[model samples]
Target chain A: METIAKQGARVQLQLNGRVREGFAEPRTQLCDFLRHELGATGVHVGCEHGVCGACTVQVDGKSVRSCLMLAVQAQDSRVDTVESLAEGELMSDLQLAFRRNHALQCGFCTAGILMSCAEFLGREPDPTESQVRDMLSGHLCRCTGYTGIVRAVLEVANERKSKNGEK
Target chain B: MKPASFDYVRPTRKAEVLELLSEYGQDARIIAGGQSLMAVLNMRMTQPKLLIDINRVEELHFIEERKNCLAVGAGVPQVELLSWPRISETVPLLALAMPWIGHFQTRNRGTVCGSVAHADPSAELPLCLKTLGGEVVLESRSGSRTVTAEAFFQGILTTDRRPDELLTEVRFPLCKPGTEYRFNEVAMRHGDFAIVSLAAVIGAGTIRLGIGGVADRPVTRDFEPGQDLSAALNETAWSLDAQDDVQATAAYRRQLVRDLGRRLIEEGH
Candidate 1:
């Protein structure tokens, strides 16, 4: 006899520094899980495939494509989205630089880009313009033409570098 | 787009996974990182009855230096090897090719064995494995066996493993010192799949050339330096019977391999 199909799987993970639990179908993507179940709509789901970097999130401190991962796979893992970077409506330094540099037009891709860049900047507090461009290569933004995004990431990197006393 | 419903099981042990595979046979698919499989499932290209997730199988996650080769477990993420200093020192070609696989986010979750198993014609890992002459370990409840990269990758999105088998690890042979290597591809965008990729390894008077994306499967040729490569390159590129796709045309792909092959060999890149 075949095993009975599971109706839903119980998934418990740390979201935005808080323990969260939900029941989802086995096929539910982490992106959908975060948005529909946890109400974390900031994790935009673009191009549902892995090409668009709009669903990027931090799983155990490493960046991963949320759309490509199942919600059940993230069980017991620490997950962070773009919203986690802000403090009570106070934008992150990267978000501030993005606004100052006019980095977003429609703002559809900003949240995911912010999350990806946040993870990148955490690892590389100081990055060259080319490196910044490389990091953005995975992302797709039709509006800004990538000029402002590159500028914003560089400005943030430079500021952090100066604060850390690194030339 | 959402994937079709499928039963999921996270087996913590290799024996459990093997038992599941044996029970489910062709109806089961092993999901490592789920980077490629998820996309395929979302597209409704495949609808397996069961998805055996091996991510929690700690026994399948490792990077070890065994006598003559580097052992990369099925659960080892692609990004992990990118930062591994020893992998860079041992298998320099793979280190140079990892960045071109995909974006950092995808690389962080995509596994080396997953890419090898998916066997996309244009993937960098398979081409690199072909150039490096790696081995793939396939296991099942019956027994286990190892197949060389050349024999393992039968065609596009195809492998030699049986329905009840799983690819456990990939062994990349350490390149001898002074082995110069170069990986170059021409993609429409920076992170897109290669239209035609060239993996060339030359040193100690041996020339190994492996090309991907322009064929149903990656093709390789070993020859001596200073030998005329045009005839062989053209022959191999044409022999593969490349087809016209949105990314590139059959004629264009054939020309690309011929041109890129000669340029890389001449520049010794």
Candidate 2:
């Protein structure tokens, strides 16, 4: 077999909600592709390695580090970014709770944390405070000391549970 | 840190992957989930001439329960295995330690076989494989071969896989009926690499222990059930060539191993 040099790899995937088609270098990180190629700057890139969790995105309904994936690797996957949480200038329920509770400061890590928590809340609508803390453990937030973030998530979870119970 | 320039290939078949590995030899690297490789590449630790992405190899993607062992393909993501009900019921040790790996994000892309191939001394999957006495399957243009976890991992970030071979599957022996298993590790944070981790399987008239992060590779030992093995475990801790690094001191790791071993045994672990 012969080795080929660097070349562009075509990437076609569902971004946010629409189909997106583009070409990226085979070595391009998924976060870079989403941020630069598709203009989804919501996916932050902190500690290009997988540690920081600042590049978390939803692939096929599961949270994953966009930085650890090649753009070409997401050939047919459905990706959800922090932008998906809002609807035409309307904030999501979780986002509203964050604002109500003062969950973010500086906001550098807010997008990734929100994305991760979005996936977690989908899976576990009714979680304990410890479970919420564990879900947030992978993410790092230097601001708000995580107190307000945890409280905000807990409030939303409780509100959802009560609303469902009422129905 | 961006990765150095390198060519990429996505082969849909395992045979093509092996052929590419053989052709590129040492200049080529197999990328399964890119969870570890991407980080290494970003740091420019290794700039291979080619990166053979194996995610498209359908033949290498599967999870099967055999007569004696459970086989996990190279393409199965770590999070997928973690959520699999069979893994929780059969190989509980793996399920327990999977969450201790990076976070949900990294686990979503990291592959089990990739972790086994990388052979990080502080990694959870390799430690679990060693504890369960798993087997790693490698294939090359010449032929295919399987190696035990003990022999497959030669050292930190090293394995017995030849440059021309591709790791296709890893088989973990099923836990015997009525066996009890426990996993414990201490890291700076929830998802950081462990300073020292211990895996214990007890019951069925046998007991086995595997320790990681204290040495170049995970070490395991088997003992008779109901025997007081604290002394033996302490001896084993001191006997290992544990290194002192920034994360921890060798003396601290030694004591941790001893204490954790004794605690696990005393708690009927």
Candidate 3:
């Protein structure tokens, strides 16, 4: 028999548009729950420690270290992972540019960089290269040298600005 | 990296929080944001019998501007504090140090109280709080009392915080106009822990300098206007006790401390 964390208070959480309800341990890490329980491997865990930024996810439109968050803390929160950035058939312009620039090599830190950039660009349409570097300074990408990575974000920022006319 | 299994409590009432802390005493570990504590627990460093989750206490999440100081709640996220313009405008040193606390992701999860409560010798907030002459409010079943920065930090990860008391809020005193403050840290990587960090607050009457990562706690030196800090560090007995660790040799850190002290005095003024 599984010991119950909450009996009557059913866990009601929204994960990328789908309603998820379950009785997970209050100490259950959201990163493990997303990948093992929900089968969404897009949110990869590199350091288990919260430094690598590989397991970042958006909780209420803010990027958070998923490894440090408990499942119960994420309850009732509007969670968005890399899986939510792309629709069924097509990916966002950021993703497309990341592919075009060969921004990722091992592809472990890509999901998080993509997620952070996607959200960051939404707030800052035309981010300078230094700004992108400042925001991306936390993420560790051993393979990509970040040459193409920074370029990919700049390309998307410029594209969005050109199309939207600097709004 | 699985943490030790432990009981948890989420107290909504302040009275309930104080009662639990008093009852549990050493067995209970209060978690504000769980950013640093969780990391330590994962590393098998600390295994408390119970975790008192204080993040849900809504009352401890405000940034109130007092008449003489700013009262920042312990449970307030660092990211939330960053968005508050008053915090940035009033205490520009903290605004400068806030960006280097960790990263955008970690900042979202880390709490100001948690960071200060942990009281790591290398952490950013502790140095800033110490330099700015901040005070922390401690609550227990009995009552509440405030501890000054100079007397608050006891040793490495140790504080005057009683076994039954919990840190609720931090008060950073207001500096007069034209107070030139500068904070700097030399970390291995951009987001990695600083090898040696320095925070200097210069005012019209005096100049206070804080150094972290070189000692077990934030070390401060007082220099009245027109005093030579370069000659002062060598004379201060406390500077002689700077310790070395795996990050950097003691000799190297001491050298940096002396050099940085001079540089901070020169540049900060």
Candidate 4:
């Protein structure tokens, strides 16, 4: 195993389905690398110590705190930020539901919440209200008091379940 | 805040990791999952010259069942252990306490051994490990040693691990038949550190109660299940030397130990 110098190292990853490369030191957090070097501005950086979920992103299909993961550690991994949640101008079903419920006030925590909810609903396609709330507890949304976020997540879960039934 | 600058190495093998540890000694730090270490780094609490990333070490990513215990490797994430199919039947106490460790997002990347290695007094894993009489495996280029949980944790955020040793795995004794277990904690929020955490294991005639957050480290005491325990519980609570903090006062912590301890002991019956 070779040690990369503290000066910097080239970290390459599949970011939101695109292969992106960025130069970062060993201490550079993934959230910073994404926003600054890889042009992923949606990866919000709040409470860089991992308490606030504003830096939450998906690494290899699992939602994790980007602030807690160093860029060097995410090398060669498939990473997904909030930018992947939308296609062109088409918002994902979960995003549409959030809009309908008005789940955001300041919208600072919405990206992280959406990323977590998206990963969660994939695992649990038909979660109960309490389960949705439990998943939402990982994220902090001081503006909305979390009522609308919970409703939006539950609504997406039910819609997905019914849509799968229609098939 | 960003972490201090440091060189990084991702070792693919456990031997390579041990070699790095042996060479760097106190100047090197092994990073697994980086859930806790990253937070500490961001705060600039302790800066290491070399950061060894062991996430790619395939040998350390395992959760195997042993003769009388479950062996979890250093690479096994908390979420993986929590969702293990046999956890509820094998280690019921751990299954109950796993959810309170951290939030779902953090657990997704937080390794089980990492939390045990961190040895936070308010953490649930250490309390459970102490109560269950688990063992921690510390390996280095010199040799390997296994330390009992009772003697492994020394103080708040301190452990018996040496600078040249890596916490390779943790062995949790499997639940025995006729033994009942109960785990409870009081925290400001669902995923926050516990102000006071209690784990009770009741067997045929003996009951063992482990308390956390009120002391520098998790402490355990054994007693006869048939006897009255109020006085003993109060005495044990006061002996912990609880201190006043922003989240909780010394008196409230002691009260929690007495009240929550009694409740868990009775609930196990």
Per-residue lDDT tens digits for candidate 2, residues B34-141, read 888989998999999889988878888899989988899999999888988888877888888888988777787889999989999999899999999899999999
Encode model 3's per-residue lDDT on A33-115: one tens digit a residue: 78877777999988877888898899888888788877666768888899998878899898999999999998999998887
lDDT of 4 by residue, A25-141 (tens): 999999999999999999899999888899899999999999999999999999999999998999999899999999998999989999999889889987888788778778888
What is the Å distance of residue B21 in model 2 from its true position?
Answer: 0.9
Q: Quote the lDDT for A116 in model 1.
A: 87
DockQ, computed on Cα atoms, for candidate 3: 0.41
In angstroms, how far off is B245's CA in candidate 3?
2.7
Give the total clashing residue pairs for model 2: 0
Backbone clashes in candidate 1 total: 0
lDDT of each: 0.89, 0.87, 0.81, 0.92
The best-first sequence of candidates by TM-score reads: 4, 1, 2, 3
DockQ (CA atoms), all models: 0.56, 0.58, 0.41, 0.86
- Which 10-residue window of candidate 3 chain A scores lowest in summed lDDT? A1-10
Clashing pairs in 4: none
lDDT of 4 at A82: 94
Stretches > 4 Å off in candidate 3: A1-10, B235-240
- Pitting candidate 3 against candidate 4, the one with the higher lDDT is 4
**TM-score versus the correct structure, for each prediction:** 0.97, 0.95, 0.94, 0.98
- DockQ winner: 4
- Output DockQ, candidate 4: 0.86
| Chain A TM-score, structure 3 | 0.91
RMSD of each candidate relative to the true structure: 1.8, 2.0, 2.7, 1.3
State the weakest 10-residue window (summed lDDT) of model 1 chain B: B260-269
For TM-score, the strongest prediction is 4
Q: After superposition, which runs of candidate 4 have C-alpha atoms over 4 Å from their true positions?
A: none
